[model samples]
Target: MCVAADWRRLYWWVVLQWVVGVATSGPCAQRCDCSPKLPLVDCSSQQLSAVPEGVPDATQVLNLTYNHLKTLSSRQFFSLRQLRELDLSANMLTVIEVEAFVGLQNLITLRLSRNRLKIIPVGAFSGLPNVQFLDISENEILVLLDDMFGEMPSLQKLEASENDLVFISNRAFSGLPNLLELRLERCNLTTVPSEAFSRLTGLQHLRFCRLGLTALPNNSFRQLQRLQDLHVSRCPWLHTLAVNSLIGLNLTSLTLSHCNLSAVPYAPLHHLVYLRYLDLSYNPITTVLSGLLGDLLRLQELHLVSTGLLHVESGAFRNLAFFRLLNVSDNRLVTLEESAFHAVGSLEVLRLDGNPLACDCRLLWVMRRRLRLRFAGHAPSCVSPVQVQGRMFQDFAESEVARTFTCRQARILTRKPQDVRSDEGHTVLFFCAADGDPAPSIIWLNPKRSVLTASGRIRVLPNGTLEVRYAQVQDSGYYLCIASNAAGNDSISVSLRVRGFPASSRNRSGSFFLDGWSFASGQTAVNGSQPFPFDVKTLVIAVTMGFLSFLSSVALCFIFMFFWSQSKGQIKHTATIQFVPRSSASTTAGRSTVETGRFTMKLI
Candidate 1:
């Protein structure tokens, strides 16, 4: 009997709620369309000047976009308790009064983009507690004050792009604790506000575009530990990035495109072990050195478009094991070599059409994988070796590859360096020049078979000239110069004889010797005995061997003295022997007939 009474009361309660909703909902406003089922109001794209009156009390979605509303007075939409979305974009909104969005407790999406609003009062969005996505882009806002958002605790994404933002208060986003993404692109940021961004701990994607800074200081985004993607584009003045700028973050995607960087910021990106997508397009970087990108072991997709890259050195991508896509289009590259990569077996997409490729043996790796690479948009073509010029890489037959894509070994252009004689204090020079299909790099090796770099007394010039400042006796030796390219290498050896006094053994590495032999003449004869060039490694080894010899001699002398003293009766010596009786194997030794003696001896 009690269960039947409860069912009857529930049915009557539903009828009472329906009666109240019908009695309270008013008729639709003039010049607007309204739906009674979902309760949506469309007052958008019209010449309505103010908020439409007589709107139904049960409306949930309101559209006021593309209108001529100039101001929003207080309590404009206070009665729309069920409102969830509000769009006022593409309007001429100049001012919004306080509590303009009051009583919008369930509002979630708000769009006020492309407006003429110069300032937004504090309480303009006071009652929007559940708004998650807010877009106020393309406005004339100059600054963001503290508490401007008015505590939208459920907000996650906020995009304020294309604003003339001149200043941003440190606490401007303090009320948005759950913000997952924030965009302030196309603003005039003098410097990255690292202190202000520390408050956004939950931010996953951060975009602070168009900075007037030359360099990002160390640990610039270290506080954004949860950040996954960071983009800084259209920053022409951002040329330098500190090695530790992206030190502590675990970003997966990074875009530093459309900047004025002269080279890749490899050091700053070396620690981004989790980075998979990288875009570094439209920079002025020229060449990438061999093995410099070895640290990016997990990179999958890479973009180096329009970077004015001329050469990709050998073994440059040797460490990228699972590489997929590479877009180096619109560069000045001559050709790419097969030796530059260790393995790109999983590569799916490639974009290398805009480069002036020679299509020679250096680029045979691309030809073999042309069908599998799936060239994006356009395929690579030959720009040199007139026989195959203007031909696509995919069109060449496998049998003609060797005949067409040929390599020209590097050949020395200038004559070998002459043997020069210098005095005790002088300088020496050796020059080497070469020519090849692709350019060759120069390297110098000393008499000790070690590669020469800029050191205390020796220097390597950019134009392949070896300069030795102080011509000491130890600097006299034969030097070898090697010019290498992708095809082959050529080398030549030269001799240097420095005449000096035996006692003039001072190292003046800090000061240069100005009085040197003229490099513009033939070899000169020296009148002194040639002394061996004192190589640093050779000297250390010789000294170590001599010390070992001295130690062995001292130890032998001690041993001899100890034996001689004993032979001359100056020291006492004792020797004792004893014999013991052996027992039977059965261990039945019940009695022993002879006394036993035992003796022990050691050979040294």
Candidate 2:
């Protein structure tokens, strides 16, 4: 008897609820065109060219997306006055006429994304006083008029990204005090007026990326009091963020990647105590000021990749106690000094690769000793002469990528031995030296066309020295010496010669001898015992070597010329042949002309 009574009571309650629903939905049913059996209406992805008037009466949800609609007239939606959510996304709409939603007084959510709408007239949505969520993203909106969104008194979320917006006027969003999220990414905006966004006091999330913004004005974001996440990345020309621009943001995540920023002031970001994730990757920043990034006490992840940094000064990261992951790869760093990573005790994953690290004795000491470190393996192995080439640290190291690493060598200049004085015929010496890895070998070229070695007349020093017993005037030609090592090779040539003697006999003896010994004016013949002081042996050797060099140069030049002529099919050759008066030239009195079949030769 108790179970039967309970069942009867439940049945009566259901009937009473149904009666209430019918009484309250009478007005909605009379305005809409949908069936009374269903409360929601759906016309999404139906290739609709215009607003559908076939909706059921008492409809609450209307979807007509993925269509080819070019316009939305206010009269078309005047019948759907009971709709609560309307979706018209993924259409080819380019315009919204005046008072487009004049009769949608009960509309709460509106979506019009992925359209080609270029403009939205003022007061277009003034009729929808109950609208809260509006998305017009992926449109061609070039400008936002002053009062384009002033009628959306109840709007909370607005997305207007992937557009051609160049400038956002002041008071464009002045009436949107309830807006929580606003995205205008990739809008091609070059300047942000100081008051452009001052009215959005309650906004929470903002994103602006891939726009060529260079700098921000001070106090640019002072009005946004509840902002939480701000992402501005992949802007190559951006450099500075003005002081206190993010004063009232109270943000949780900040990203500024590929911005070409070299330095940042620490005081500007001090107010962001709630920041958790910060990314400054793919920039050209070289130095981090003391206590710069350390001010972010709540930071959990920091990315500093490809920043061209060379040194990390101690205490640079002293205040990052809350950081969990740090990436410092693709930089020009050679070594990490002790205590460089001191305050990163809370770090769990560390990345340090793509850096040309010199693994010499100094770095070896660092590898063997430093304590309290928490890394996976040997800092991913310094890719010295071996490059990492777009691969990760672990991947490059796992393939035994260290075998190609080697040291670089220095370059040296070489010269040939020459006579210092023509009268005395004193022998001159030449040498070439360079500091290198694997030590370079020096080859000396002598006037005798032979490789020189260390022995009396010709000597070679460990420091790469070449000496000649007696230099002569004939030893005046090009001499080349090469020094090679692991890194590369270099060669130099010096023209060797003797000093010219004076033309007069008075410049050869007595007072001339004394002056000759003191100065170079008369310093050729000391005793006048040897005529010319010519070393025949040295001269013969030098002449022979010079002749050989000349012949070789001529042969090489001819070979190059032949190949070049064949490649281009052009021969530039012209000769002028002169003829003297012949003894028996009485036979030809006229213009003397000698010609062959296809050759014309004239004598003048």
Candidate 3:
């Protein structure tokens, strides 16, 4: 044994150089692509200007996307401590240094989307305490200060939508108490800071579309108490919403579409009692009043499409029980009041075509109620009466439209003769045609009964015609024409008579003749030239007492139709005569034949 084979050949050459330095230290790394059966490290779009040191310390996905990586300094992935996904998204990232995600404590997804990140400094996400998805969306970041996402206490989704984000400071997002989802869409947020979402108390989906928010103030979303889908839309200068904004929201789905909202502030949506799905579509909201969506009792689906709505009042969808789906399509609705959907008793999808719906009988309760309306078969037509204009509401016939549709009560179809005389300063029209069913309300009261108010030469027109213009003499007497609806009121008076010259005949001056002929002696005279004598025996006794009062009203209407046709034919021949009372009659007849012997004559 020559010295025991030289110490066993130097212990097999030091175990072959320590197994060749652990097999060449594995993660290859020249221009990255380390895979090793999937610990992945692609180094995407590699035009890399940094962040590429020998990766693979068991790298757990680290795609430096479209890389031109500019400054992410401090410990930039200090040898990928088993990085759990870190895609410096489309990077040209301008500064991130602070702790620059210190040694990403198991970073669970951190993208930094399309970056030129304007500002994020404060601890630059200190050590990404287990970052749970953060995007930094299309960034130029702009302003977010305070805790600037306070070092991601397990962030749960944030997008910073197309950011140039105007200002966020306060507690920036108070260390993200597990943020659920926040997008800040197209940001330049004009104002929302007061408690900037009070620390997102476990936020649950919030979007901020094209904002320049004019007002959403009061406790601005009261710390999103478990917010559930709140998408603030296009915000054209937002338009006030304060009353405790969304009080302690536990919302389900609230959109606030196109937001130039004219009105929808029912005490800040009455606290969204677990709101279900409400859009407030394209808002310029004209009218939807009655208790304004009641209290949204767990409302189901209500969009109010193209909200320039004209009227929806009647109990405005009451307490929307479990309201199904109602869009109120393209608004300016013409007529709906037959209890305007009475209270949406679980309405099953009703879009109401594109409105202008005035299909008579007030839509006959939607064609005699069976409401399962979906409107895909395109119905809601009738813009109005020209014999059912475009006729469609399910081709109507609810009892032939409730027997030829007649809501009659306000009947004043202008039959003329209510005495009108206008000549003072001329101009007089009157005319009021009414006949009703849901279309009445004419109102023109005047002769001191009040209500006639259309100023300067008086007007009223729109078909109910009144137009007085220059007629003075205090516009003479009685002028009603009321005409109400819901089947009731029906006025008609008229009698105007504004002739002329009577302010005590212009202070008794004389010579008045524009057809109201008067040569002097006056108390007011027209045509009759009164002031005394012209009596041909009282004009033959007033034309024989008006021709004996028109033949005494035609002999009292022919003696009341001949005694009402002889008392209606003696009550119909005494109910078809039927009397056979005879037994004792036979006996009495034979006895009376003589009264003890008299000649009895029987006649048939």
Best by TM-score: 1
Could you tell me the TM-score of candidate 3?
0.34
Q: What local lDDT does model 2 show for residue 187?
A: 81
- Candidates arranged by TM-score, highest first: 1, 2, 3
Task: Give the per-residue lDDT of model 3 (tens digit) for 152-241.
Answer: 787787888998888887778887887888888888878876576788888888887888888887777776789889899998878879
Winner of 2 and 3 under TM-score: 2
Model 2 segments beyond 4 Å from truth?
1-45, 103-106, 265-267, 335-338, 356-604
Candidate 3 — which residues are off by over 4 angstroms?
1-37, 40-75, 78-95, 98-118, 121-134, 137-158, 161-188, 191-212, 215-258, 263-284, 287-308, 311-350, 353-412, 423-433, 438-455, 461-604
Top candidate, metric lDDT: 1
Candidate 3: 10-residue stretch with minimal lDDT:
525-534
TM-score head-to-head 1 vs 3, winner: 1
lDDT of each: 0.80, 0.67, 0.73
Q: Record all residue pairs in model 1 with backbone atoms less than 3 Å apart, i.e. clashing.
A: 315-340, 578-597, 578-598, 579-597, 579-598
lDDT of 2 at 465: 67
lDDT of 2 by residue, 435-521 (tens): 665457787765555565666444566778666544445555455577875457777765566654454753542212223434355
The C-alpha local distance difference test score for the whole of candidate 1 amounts to 0.80
